[model samples]
Target: MTSSAFTESSLTGIPVKRGKVRDVYDFGDRLLFVATDRISAFDWILAPGIPDKGRVLTQISRFWFERFTTISNHLLSMDPADLPLPADTDLEALRGRCMVVRKTEVVPFECVVRGYLSGSGWKDYQATGAVCGIDLPAGLKQSDQLPEPLFTPATKAESGHDENVSFEVMSQAIGQELADSLREKSVQIYQQGSEYARERGIILADTKFEFGLLDGTPILIDEVLTPDSSRFWPAETYQPGGAQPSLDKQFVRDWLETTDWDKNSTPPVLPDQIVEKTREKYFEAYKMLTGEECTW
Candidate 1:
């Protein structure tokens, strides 16, 4: 099946706010968030959506939510299965991924925790000798493991890119105690997630997580460990020298890089083959990491 094969229908009576990928509908004190098959890379939404991409993301999120809820608070209900759903709640259509979570006021910051040197962290370190605010050991190369994981937080931008803020800047913004707590929690969550993925033959090379305040306490909200919000590299092809072939959307990213399309401009529509390959990649990642069949 192709992206053209799955167009989203508006939820009955429920208003929605669509993001780059997910469509979020208000549900009183909670929210019903649905991940679509749309795929985005390099901050651009590419053409030819990945079939089952949304279901894969949702299943992964649900897995992590079940695994780590005891470690910290998350936006979950006791009976997630009974939440209000669409008329076509057929397991295949709704999948096992769609989430009906308690909505909280989203924090204005993105709590990024890194166990390795790569991505934006590498770029920032190469230029400024630091990542976010934490200074790093000299002579660190791309994909080099950090001595210890670090918490690098960034301010969530409204329109453009999110600016990486230092720990000091973060402290001043949200108070020292809360800042410290957020950083600690972020590192702990990353540690658990990274270990879990590693055992499943995937290197979760640093991912970002979001937290929100519910009744004055922080709870993990939004998607966690999805390809859209992460850098997933297959363990078999993993190499430390250069850019790794990722199970995420590197296929799309690579194609975009070979084109004349500027990153700042509108991205070109993806070819059918590229979209199909990307969809298979997402499905494979979900299966390998979770050890579960992509039923949807």
Candidate 2:
């Protein structure tokens, strides 16, 4: 995503925070969250971005925010017409990818729930036969479904990848009551998300969620079920014997894997076609899951 599409000068709200893809401006008791098209991988922001990536992610989050409202409290106030946007703001230009949400103090932990063996969980399992201190059955391979959904909490690292910790560690960091609530809520959200995606012919292998508290109540915050935050596998191509074809950034990761460049070193610039195809995949996931056109 080009920086030209979003300028700090154009945003007029109380400054709250900024992250890799979003610039959040506080609006009194609410927030204006802007999604940018910037792409990050291996914990590094690349030189180029896939156009419309932000919109796709935003649209996906909007869809889930609507779909999941019955399950939990989420930070979404999607009514553009009623929002207190700047007078000259291009509301239409930001369509499909922005939200005006309630400003809530974020919970200390990032609630991550994994249903399959992959990524860092897989790496940790391969090393210790356990994930977040939960032991798994022997001889399990990559992409294997767990006996039950696992609650893997991780420290919200400032930069680079977040580090996974056991449930005990989570309770130690946060209070026992909040920790218990986070784990239960995380699993419930994942189960609902996975089941919903399954009906759409996609496998929700895993996903990460962030939660914030409004008073004593927990509310979901940040992005939800976007390609940037979840792993999607096409149901038809999913096989337990091999690496499943993913619908997220697997294409980008695979391209990087074949290169000689170390992930820590300068990341090789993504090619034009790869960027285009990746962008399409993000849109495809949003479309198939929501059954709605990505209009931004």
Candidate 3:
């Protein structure tokens, strides 16, 4: 299949917000979320996007949202035909890449759950034998599985890196009742996803979730369990002492690290080889988890 990329999207209605990869349109009681093919790394949206990435991410989230019936979510439908699209809208372009969902006041924290020692959690553990103020056992190596998944929250920053914050801090900022609820739900969702992925020969190391409130009820919002929001490693080659091969954006990050360009500047356009490989990784993760090929 030929690859197609959408760096940005323009709809008839004014966009309420534009994230690194999604363009959200307000529809009074609901929202229209369009997942573009735009890719981001080091907190910067790169020049070129991986092809069919939006469809892969959208479909994967749809698969999880349908299965997570134990909790409430913002998803209404993935079919563009169900959305209140503007007249003359390109339905074909939006198919499988857009969602119609209930609107809510989004929480200000990034609800993260870590099942393994890697990424920032690994760095924090190496520095203080703890992650997000929660102490762990001594001598845990990189990518080592934690005794159990930990709910480590972070402040949701609009720009720059998200700083890890303790549960106490989170409770103070969002109230003890709400903080406790978010933590419990985040961990539960992560556990469910990890088990499902493990059975499919993939390791869902960790994932971050975003939540919002609708009439004082917490609901899962944004993308869920997509490669862009989680670290997925192949179970066949799982090794704990070092960085494991991944089925996520680690490929792009590894290539970026080899360049002389500092992360602060505008990211360079990805070469064709890198873009294709990244697309394949995203598609592979979706296929492995969903047991179906991407329609796009």
Candidate 4:
């Protein structure tokens, strides 16, 4: 891992908004998105960013955004030089890690699609035989493939964890028509992505997507189907009876579980070995899905 990692970005002539991993710079007409190498587990941003993680994430998202043209998205271009950045900005530093995207009125919900019973969905099923008020078959094991992919939406929170809500609640908040459209589009995107991943010996267990309206037209926004937003399990090693082996942030999550730190409060700094292993897993996932090595 390199000693240099981009945790935040500052550019002239743009207003900035920092998230858990991405840095957004508003340019009045468009937005500049920079995927930093910062990794967050349990909603806490950890120290010592993962090397080349930003480039890997940017390329992976670009791959999916271009491939899934059946749905509209906010991506304009990945090249920083092509964008209207200020003359003083560092183009080389932003290359491969930045995106110039169309700005839109972002919807205030997290459009989630689950192809398998895992994570919170599994817990919800075990407790009430339903996930987000959608009933599931009895006796479904962890990591088991569901009968069909489900559209489970949750409220987008600025801090802490996002709370899962019923579709009816989502509809009431965002209007039934827009909510329905988001659900349909989310399921379609997940199905297409999952089918492609299965052929590559990876399982797209579940993923969350964000949407925005451009002149009243809903287009996919934010990071789509990255390791931070989805679970990627190895198909050959998949066993529904237990937690499946993954090529995503599950590596980091599993390691964090072993630490003595409580889920609340400040997170402990990760060891060097854990950081290297996590970086390897992220790169492996990009290569496995796209069949292309990350040059950075």
The most accurate candidate by lDDT is: 3
Better of 1 and 2 by TM-score: 2
Candidate 4 — which residues are off by over 4 angstroms? none
Which portions of model 3 miss their true places by more than 4 Å?
none
Evaluate model 4: give its lDDT: 0.89
Residue pairs with clashing backbones, model 1:
none
Worst lDDT run of 10 residues, candidate 4, spans: 1-10
Model 2 TM-score, 2 decimals: 0.91
Instruction: Give the clashing pairs for model 3.
Output: none
- Please state the error at residue 89 of candidate 2 in Å: 3.3
Query: Per-residue alpha-carbon lDDT of model 4 for 227-294, expressed as tens digits?
Result: 88999998999998878888888888888899888988888888899888888888899999999887
Model 1 regions more than 4 Å off: 2-9, 73-92
Please list the residue runs of candidate 2 whose C-alpha ends up more than 4 Å from where it truly belongs after superposition: 1-16, 79-83
Give per-candidate clash totals: 0, 0, 0, 0
Q: Give the TM-score of candidate 1.
A: 0.90
**Against the true structure, what is every candidate's RMSD?**
2.5, 2.5, 1.2, 1.2
lDDT of each: 0.77, 0.79, 0.90, 0.89
Model 3: worst 10 consecutive residues (lDDT sum): 7-16
Candidate 1 residue 175 Cα shift, in angstroms, is 2.2
lDDT by residue (tens digit), candidate 2, 22-138: 777777887777787777788877656777887787778887887886555555566554567777777766765677788787876778888999888798899999887889999
